[model samples]
Target: MEPEYWDKNPFKATAKAFPPGFHYRPTTLNKTRKFYEFILVDTNSVSIKHFKDPKDPNLNTHSTIQILKVMQPRHYGSNLNQPKKFSAPFDPTRYTYWDYIDAWTNVFWHQNNKYKHSWLIYFKNNTTYNFPNWFLQWWNYFGPIPQIYPEEVQQGFNQFSRMFNNQESRIPADLMYFSSFALSWIFSWQYRYGKIENKFDNSKAALDQVKNWFQVHPEFLKPADPETSLFLNKKSQLAIFLAGSKSKEILAKNLKEVLHLLQQQEEEEKPSKKKVESSDENDDQDDDPFYQNEDDCFGISLEED
Candidate 1:
């Protein structure tokens, strides 16, 4: 044997090398469910792309990556009267709760608690797409969402709402907290579950969807920075505990004011922080989303959505 270099837990060395808990837990549970849900239509999305090009050895790998980035599903109306979000140019094409509902019903298999096997659906479907073996399981890039319970959903909604109650301002960019990372699923679920699930008109329901979510709690709009640890105010936290309706636009307008204010504060303090986090701060993007990315398919506009 080579020099006996050992520790109490052989696994512990690798685990400790990363942040605490980084390597210790299962992280795939959420994204798998979401993707499976995305492909639930009569003709699944992933099913259409199976191919192998004779010219390029890497064609499969290239195509596989492209498909995964298509993680956000786009649907169109056939005859359902309801159109899918981002579908082909139509009289109207925006995501509605009904389409979402139909998709999730089959995707989740929530009927029998044991349909939990649907969790494997993503892997199967991706393989079903018959992508190059290389990129198929290359790495797990997105996950750990939708495991949200109704309670946490309510809490996130409440946290955001309370921050805007009666205020007129911008909100902290980080007010969404994990939402910046999780909104692809959470915001959709929270609003849909909170407002439109009832027998309500489309426009009215959309407005209410935003409103009712912010109505209960407000802490959700404050900015969070690693340098400054600000706690959610007690009164604000209390309202989350209470049950009450709120107005989203009013709260949102207020929250936006707070965000603007915070943005101002950050600008004012930037001179000093420039000396500190200059190495850590990420490049800010204040312009259009179609900013160039040489790495992606050149013509697919980032602003398409």
Candidate 2:
């Protein structure tokens, strides 16, 4: 039988078209308006049709190949609802299929909607399965999957940081610095309030990472430049404030010392107004001796006499 006929009439006409004694009955459990499922009588053979309207005999079958070419045999007992037990206890050393499920689901949830399609393509091209593991894992978690573990997030952050650091030629240094700064602040806030138990500790750890980044690249926090220093100071103050009540005092103290150092550096780099005025006066005196020794009542230099 031609697949196009099957696509046009689905199981409706296919069951009747089959030779006499061939048993086929539609299964209701998996049947939907757009999809039809049928099983052979006295046999385990089953077929699913992605048909919108079986009554329309002229329905286009152009996309039918796309659906049929990828269809795999559905093993009845291997459904996701059926739990499997392994002989040995769960092993952390070797990952089962489930680990990839959790990892990919967490990635999908964290990505922006626009970027999600790229993730879909990446998984489709890279993995053996057409769908991501997380889609199945979602049912096991009983709700939306938990945010990725902190260690995984930290690893991602570090990897991005390294990538940004290496792209100096492609991206401007200042833009990279600002991007990292914004990312650090965002991550710090998320760590504090993203339903983590150790909110304060995680937030502080995130801020500490930002602090270390600034320490390594001091030019990004140039005290003499108001443009750079203003943002640096604001970020530091915000980070300290977000450190929670417990660590507020310690963070405040450390931040105060940093600001004090910046102030001192600013002062040392700037020329004093009084020194400039004094130098100008000395130049005037050297140009005209009379200006320095205001000769008695005549404003004439004694040396000229």
Q: Best candidate, lDDT-wise?
A: 2
Model 1 error, position 42 (Å): 9.6
Worst 10 residues of 1 by lDDT: 112-121
TM per prediction:
0.19, 0.18
Task: Encode model 1's per-residue lDDT on 18-126: one tens digit a residue.
Answer: 3432322223323233333443332343322222336643332111111222222223335445544543332223434344433332233221111111121122211
Question: How does candidate 2 fare on TM-score?
Answer: 0.18
Q: Write candidate 2's Cα lDDT for 255-303 as tens digits.
A: 6877787699679856776688889988988789677565555855568
Off by over 4 Å in 1: 1-101, 110-159, 165-305
Q: Report, for every candidate in turn, its global Cα lDDT versus the true structure.
A: 0.35, 0.36
Model 2 misplaced stretches (Cα beyond 4 Å): 1-51, 61-252, 268-305
